[model samples]
Target: MLLHLPEGGRVVHEEHAPITLPKGWFRVIRQREYVPGSVRIVAD
Candidate 1:
């Protein structure tokens, strides 16, 4: 997915520190985790 921070902004989450984004376009990628048998997207 793609995210656009037209005027810049901040992304916040309880388990992570806030991310400051510049005014531009960004590609969104899901965090991945490795398990015993497979790989999966990390839950946020």
Candidate 2:
């Protein structure tokens, strides 16, 4: 996964993965992360 922090907001890129869901059977994959609030923003 690739993450980009632009001047306005944040961007994220993720690769597909396999996952199981309740009630039904399915597969899915995703990438994600959390950014700290201490980071400075250009607008806010």
CA lDDT of each prediction against the hidden true structure: 0.94, 0.38
Q: Which stretches of candidate 2 lie over 4 Å from their true place?
A: 1-26, 37-44
1-44 in candidate 1: lDDT tens per residue? 99988999999999899999889999999999999999999986
Q: What's the lDDT for candidate 1?
A: 0.94
Which pairs clash (backbone N, Cα, C closer than 3 Å) in model 1? none
TM-score of each predicted structure versus truth: 0.71, 0.19
TM-score computed on alpha carbons, candidate 2: 0.19
Worst 10 residues of 1 by lDDT: 13-22
Q: Measured by C-alpha RMSD in angstroms, how accurate is candidate 2?
A: 14.9
Which candidate leads in TM-score?
1
Residue 8 Cα positional deviation in candidate 1, in Å, after optimal superposition: 1.2
